[model samples]
Target: MIPPKGKPLSDFPSLPPGFRFGTSTAAYQIEGAATEDGRGPSIWDEFCARPGTIADGSSGAVAADHYHRYAEDVALLKGLGAHGYRLSVAWPRVQPAGEGTPNPKGLDFYDRLLDALVEAGIEPMVTLYHWDLPQALEERGGWLDRATAERFAEYAGHVAARLGDRVAHWVPVNEPNVTALLGYALTAMAPARGLSFDALPAVHHQLLGHGLTVQSLRASGAASIGTATNHTPVWPASDDPADHEAAAFYDLLWNRLVADPILLGAYPDGFAELMPGPVADDLKIIASPLDFYGANYYNPTAIQAPGKPSAPATATAAGHVEVPSDLPFQFAPMTGHPRTDFGWPVVPEGLYELIMQLRERYPSMPPLYITEQGCAYNTPPDADGVVDDSARVAYYDAHLREVARAIADGADVRAYYAWSLLDNFEWAEGLTQRFGLVWTDYETLRRTPKRSYHWFAELIAAQRA
Candidate 1:
């Protein structure tokens, strides 16, 4: 049964047996030992240091301080009744220079974190790279250079050989599409290059890196390995042919460009011709088989032709910037939808459309898992140190219902990991956006469970009941 909005989760349908529930976090966002334990600077470190780069003029220097207080953080996950935790290993921490000898101290920190998670009965799924490229590598052209891919393979071999015994599930990279577009093309994120389509090389190299990492992980006997790619359904602003044409192109660029190479072993239609270095040979590497496919979904995008005027709308609750006018397509706000605190439209049903489309499009599609899904609500704790975020709770309920509906429709989805477990430093946005079940006090680094946390815990327990 579908649980009505604002009601208890008791009426919600249970996920299938062995369906995993978890929370995800990136290292640079939470682990704030930025300079400790021989950890080198990342591109993020350099990006955050620049004036006027981050929205709040802040950096993740301290973040949630998870590096020193990971045990406390794990307790939060344990209390939430989560079966898994998807976390990223900072590349700069693992290989301070992005090459050469490994950092013993860096590896030791994760060793302790994994031990703690295992003790708490939480499965750890590790993501090798999550946009925090070592600054040393950026100085040598970063992802733009093909050598970075080779270096990434070497680093992956080292990490897999050491942690593969404990970590069965591996994610080679997280959202390379975001890294390429936001960071390189738009300069909206770290390693702010703003090179536009000139950054296409980054896309090819990152995927090559992912493929190489997968091969390295397999060599180390890793069980399940996949990469997380962010996706959103594209909608025309109206039924006009111009809007339709724009949406089609945007869809190819945003969704198909990333998924096609991974799932179908070729670029969308003609995009491969545009990519540099290799047009065919690398496609073989990029199309390596996966145990499961990971997707990060937020909402559908409404696109209009470049010359068409965008619809007048209030700012999004999710704080996504107004779509740039210089783009080939314009973005219009989704009408008649609830908005998250960051001004993002709440469209739980979009998740259903996205996954069903994937099942329809790819014959070789593997079991699906949501690597990241969450809404940012900057709600503060009350005087009693409690955050009552009923909206976030309702958001999860509505979205999970869509997930269940998709599964019933034969999507083969096996797991769902919330975007984050705690409020940490959101890249570029600094710490302003809080997309966490647990409210984190930036000053004290104290974690207080929000109402959503209790709701999710009860839902997880019910799934097992």
Candidate 2:
């Protein structure tokens, strides 16, 4: 890994031809006109209202005001010199009830935004959903109900029909595993945070939605289609058989759970039995083929053997994976690595390891992209409107070099987009954390690109040159 110091783009490693560098943001996280332009309230709008749901007691009510300041945001995108911008469609804004006629105003907002992005010299990469389900859908069992899959196709059709003309790259869903685990098994931190063994259906239906959506988009002439998943390496902590078994279980859930279906067109063996329902039919839809794969990687996991007969999951609030408590391999904090403020390990080499595994395993693996890569540092602003967020800058510099290294190693790593363009409403943590290279003055709805912005801009320019 490159040393933890802010490095300019010229100092970074070389990338291949047509390798595009970009930045990403989401609807609910940045566009804060909660009630603007006929947009309906999302599950997050209500979720944040319930006291203690968000750490800062803040909601996306008036986030970065991207709704009104989008022109300025696009200008910032131009200055960053990124070729693409990834953002999500607010399901509520598109279809407030999750199944109905399209919301014209909501649709218009995106039309204008996409046009603005193109005007500013940026290609738009749209993610159909980013965990912000329309509240109406959650009322109808959300992802848990198989109907949600059908509704998602309708929504995808609406998006594709309008923007699909210019928008070629589409991600059906962002982090389906995180949506199922965090929103279901892991304590309902998101909308429909229903923690029941029954939530297994939610996982199946979500993947089904991804598969069906891909089919729908393919039929519509989408040249490229894929989904984003978060992955990490699982290591057995000891030589014991139990720990080995435990590590295998962790790998199945974290890695294969989402990938096997898209690549192999089936679920991992025995995964169906662990799931709640008889998924014979659902598996058919779950294992849909795709043109590419996107992985949102952060850190690796160490697992010991299992104490219990079943392989328990580790989606609880403690950040602990349930392995055999007294077995050979045990989950522990990342060693020999620095941790982020959220206590996530900052291991850039893990990114290299992740890319290599994908290449060696999936023979049909599509071009890999780092969909979301950035860190949260408490970067407070100064009077000059500039955030000297050197920590975040350093974090990104180290990660980007590893990305180039992966490209050099035949990983087919095509693009690297920073997690965000501006600080807005971070889920669970709310506005308490900042992950953007540009600082958002929530009070004024003003955006100031940080030093990392200029550094990355120069880097992108140099890489392209």
Candidate 3:
């Protein structure tokens, strides 16, 4: 259960020394100026242009105006007492066509942002790509083509050459599985293709891109490199054998498929045969050792055999990826847990379970970071201009306790980055979901620090003390 609002930080479990606190934001989701300063269009730009594709028929063309107001956002981060900030570099922005000469103005934007972050004494964790594939690349078959992965390595080299000196940590890709599954197989996100399981090529190419990016960053003098993959504990709907099998498959696809290649240097038996290219050679690159492993967790998922009566009507019925009925598995709602505004189950213990599972599953796993963890609560600023999002405060409180618990059990957890620092464009959901500690007025692009923001600032202060 969520603790009541105003609960003191002293009541929560203590974190170990050097446990960093930070916040994460994606480029397409927050950094607007889609077509500004020679910026080429991304697949999302085209995706949002399609009628009825986005929930609110909204586009991120001017999202939060972060491109113009990053300094203001940096001030908020400093005020929040964040030790580090994780931000993604827009691929199209750096290379408008995802290739050829890098755009000077585009690189200048990040140069200024990183400068501000360093000046404020905050460490910068830069993710090389966050699903904003250049439209030019997508037109050339995107991740489905091996050339795209090669292009990504080139792109990574360009960014590292310019900013490697400033970025303390490098994440090559943000949630590659989600990109392949949602955008390629499910057709629910950008560059929608609805290729179903046939999207396996996209998966292989993305992992290859990640491995290649890691090499590029290292060659450019990147000292710290890691991943930010979304993970969930898959629960079977019932005791039936079919349900158990389906759950195992979903777990393998959602969790192990991306991780085993990186951590174990091998795919879960026989799966490598499905990928294109020289599987053995690519796995060698994909398995490059990392300095740390980042897990982006929200909640546990329940899975059941396809065609079950209890299955959700659509894959995204639970506000996640869409699952076609023809698939071997289906999504089921978890019961008895509080639900976020996005309808994701609030199973804080899932975070603990995932950390421990990672430790046991891959003994050689590097230190872990909770790169993204937060709930969506669209609590508007009440009349006095104060946004009191107590539910979100409680959510963080409960989750942080689990992080502490994992540490007590000997997980080498290093950091916790809230999902975002400000409410911004939410992709297909547009501005419909608010996951930020700072509430954003879309109409005015003004940021108001919510009650949870102050609560977290105090938590960070108390931790440092």
Best by TM-score: 3
Best by lDDT: 3
TM-score of 3: 0.98
Query: What global local distance difference test value does model 1 have?
Result: 0.87
Weakest 10 consecutive residues of candidate 1 by summed lDDT? 313-322
The alpha-carbon deviation from the true structure for residue 433 of candidate 2, after best TM-score superposition, in angstroms, is 0.8
Off by over 4 Å in 2: 1-4, 7-11, 192-196, 237-241, 273-284, 304-331
Q: Cα miss at 250, model 3 (Å)? A: 0.1
TM-score (all chains, Cα) for each model: 0.96, 0.91, 0.98
- Give the clash total for candidate 2: 8
- lDDT of prediction 3: 0.90
Model 1 alpha-carbon drift over 4 Å, by segment? 1-5, 311-319, 322-326
lDDT of each residue in 1-465, candidate 1, tens digit only: 223345667778767889999999999999998999999999999999999888898787899999999999999999999999999999999999999999999999999999999999999999999989999999999999999999999999988777777785899989988888778776778798888788889999999999988888887888899878889988998899988999998888778888999999999877888888766989899888899999999888898887766755423212344456677787765788877767778889899999999899886798999999998988798888789887888899999999999998887999999978999898878898999999989988888999899989989999988
For residue 453, give model 3's deviation from the true position in Å. 0.6
Ranking by TM-score: 3, 1, 2
Q: After superposition on all CA atoms, what RMSD does each candidate show versus the true structure? A: 2.1, 3.5, 1.4
Which has the higher TM-score value, candidate number 1 or candidate number 2?
1
